[model samples]
Target: EGIENTNYFVQTSKKKVILTIFENRVKKSAIPKFMEILIFCSKNRIKCPKPLADSKGKFINEIENKKYGIFSFLDGKSKNNWNKRDCFLVGKTLANLHNKNLRRSFKLVNNLGILSLKVLYNKLKHKINGLIPNASKPISDEIKFLTKEWPRCLPKGLIHADLFPDNVLFNEDSISGILDFYFSCHEILAYDLAITLNAWSFFDGQFKKEFFNEIFKGYETKRKLNKLEKDKINLLLRGASMRFLLTRLYDMVYVSENELLEKKNPIEFYKILKFHQNLENINDYIK
Candidate 1:
């Protein structure tokens, strides 16, 4: 179900667990930081994977030059499509995640941030003209616009940068778990909201206004976004769209085949990027 790592369900006599073999994209040194996040979440009463340590008190293990870890399996299923309540719950959960107070400052660089996006764009710039036809110029132009317009000095925090539908698990009406924190990083808090908005508020190549409004409704209950966050959200939305578009395009162009992974369509976000590009005012995004 996960795109970045090889995962398996291991059912022992006592309990069930998830065994994850870290893929090449995962950095071995960063595995501990990921565990720290899970531990932190568990301590805060948030439902997430808990890393199981070995007999030697080590969280990460190595086998055949590959790093691996075992995590206590979550007990809910992910939804392919979500209703307004689901959107509200996910939005509230994300806001709760951002509102936590870390005892000490943590720094984990976002490998998929703005500069990295540009590097990936340049790598695939020539190839895109052949595949998508006339997409190169718009993407390149967006790259410059986003890089220049990206805001700084907004609210910053630890965020689940990739909170897509498949990453959240639901049990009946309540959210039971939040999965896939490998893309988590210290970034703009509103940017995390933008990523969530992009992921959950679009379907069948169109944006849903009701879904977007409910998300804001639920999120404000926990942590309120300032006026600046509201004003700059469209730009952040564009950034989020471009980020996923470039990554999906990279998977489409590069040959890194794995039976466990499925390549997502970049065109889904291409349309989304176009929507943001043609926006007349910030009110179009909100009521």
Candidate 2:
């Protein structure tokens, strides 16, 4: 269940629903918290799925030692490429999600926090060079540099750390729904924005300036970024890239080369990381 939580769509009389089977990749205890996040977002007028309980009024059901959940499917299609307008709306919507105060607290530590990232890095430190050919050096150096550089005193809040394009659904000019909140957790809010910058603006191994500025502009329309968040965002961007790179590297190495599973290239994030590492000021991204 490393990356294999299976989700299937089921048609209902009125609308579609999604049934998710929680694989071992996700700890079972976090299911309740996930349900809470979705419900919280829905209550706040965000376009997201509402968790549906089974006939027993249980959100999480058990069968054969596995957990199951149901969600009302949102009516929109996921986007592979977003225009400038879509980026703006996504940015504003994301900021709105961050600024929202949930009615209750749900505590699940960020699995991709600095400490966890380091642990993953160390896990691959030995076989990295042999496995990927000249990949270990930059990862090692990035981890060391980020440890010394990434800010720890930034403002923290709930964040959907995995805000990639595929996880977002579009309806005409707006984001109909934000999907995939499994990575939601309490973390530095600015770091979450940084992750989006890396995901939304950086592409094809290059950073797009126009898309980057438009997103920050829309984000400011909802909640303005303070000087500290603006200044250290580059460091956050680099760290986010490293986090992804290490995770992808681990996935690539751990899986047998002979297996039929498709392996994603870890080097793509490496190029993005290298680009962000060279930028000095946050103004380079947002201004």
Candidate 3:
């Protein structure tokens, strides 16, 4: 259902399912960990897809050397535009995801680690030339600073790194499902919150302070943020902005003609990074 994977809606006599054919970038060895995390989250009452087994009991299998997987179809529509209640519900669910995964340790490491991000930035600079003229200086400076300043010692756990609004589904007033664990990895938990803030707290190029508060409040109800996490959140926010911006930028520049994915505006996250750069305290995110 995304750029990296081909998805099809499947219907059987008894139930509906989604079948996914992973693209080439996905490593074959890592399939088990992804399936493991999905099963683990489902068993812990998290709203996510569970991996279904094949005739041989494999969660995933290869047909013509292409890896494919099957998952139960979660019944809910993805809401692109969310109100405060939506924000709070997503916040609580996200916190639940973090808490549930935090207790379990996975052997897989974050493939998109700090070093790879820096490398992405370098590739971005060369590819993005003249596209955003006069944009390089500031972005370069932020990347350079974060190279040394990105925190690594914070509380580490699994996070759904791609928890944008569309990935969260709501049925009436409650969140019914959380989708897309393909990007999940072990990292600083606060960084996950930062990504959520950038995704949910901003709309139409402006920050919604009340929505941010609702989200943060809902999050704290489940997992309390430490002083360090609060203090370093702005930096983490910048890092999150950079992460999305680079990925979107790359997609926009090099997207294939027949690709079925939407290209997000990289400039949206550029503005977010700019706003985070101006923050003097964590309260800047709260009203």
Kindly provide the TM-score of model 2 when superposed on the true structure, using C-alpha atoms: 0.92
Worst 10 residues of 1 by lDDT: 100-109
Instruction: Say which prediction, candidate 1 or candidate 3, comes out ahead on lDDT.
Output: 1
Worst 10 residues of 2 by lDDT: 1-10
In model 3, which range of ten residues has the least summed lDDT?
Answer: 127-136
Off by over 4 Å in 2: 1-4, 102-104, 255-263
Q: What lDDT tens digits, residue by residue, belong to model 2 across residues 15-90? A: 7898888766578889889888988889889888789987888888987999988988877887767777877887
Q: Write the per-residue lDDT of candidate 1 for residues 27-131, one digit (tens) a residue.
A: 888888989998888889888889999899998999999999999998888888789999998889999998883343458888899878889998999888776
Best by lDDT: 1
Question: Which ranges of candidate 1 are over 4 A from the true structure?
Answer: 101-104, 258-260
Q: State model 2's lDDT.
A: 0.81
Better of 1 and 2 by TM-score: 1
* Candidate 3, 139-199: lDDT as tens digits: 7788888878988779989988888887887787788888877778888888888899889
> Which candidate would rank higher by lDDT, 2 or 3?
3
lDDT accuracy of residue 220 in candidate 2: 88
- Per-candidate local distance difference test: 0.86, 0.81, 0.82
Taking every candidate in turn, the Cα RMSD to the unseen true structure, in Å, is 1.4, 2.6, 1.6
* Deviation from truth (RMSD, Å), model 1: 1.4
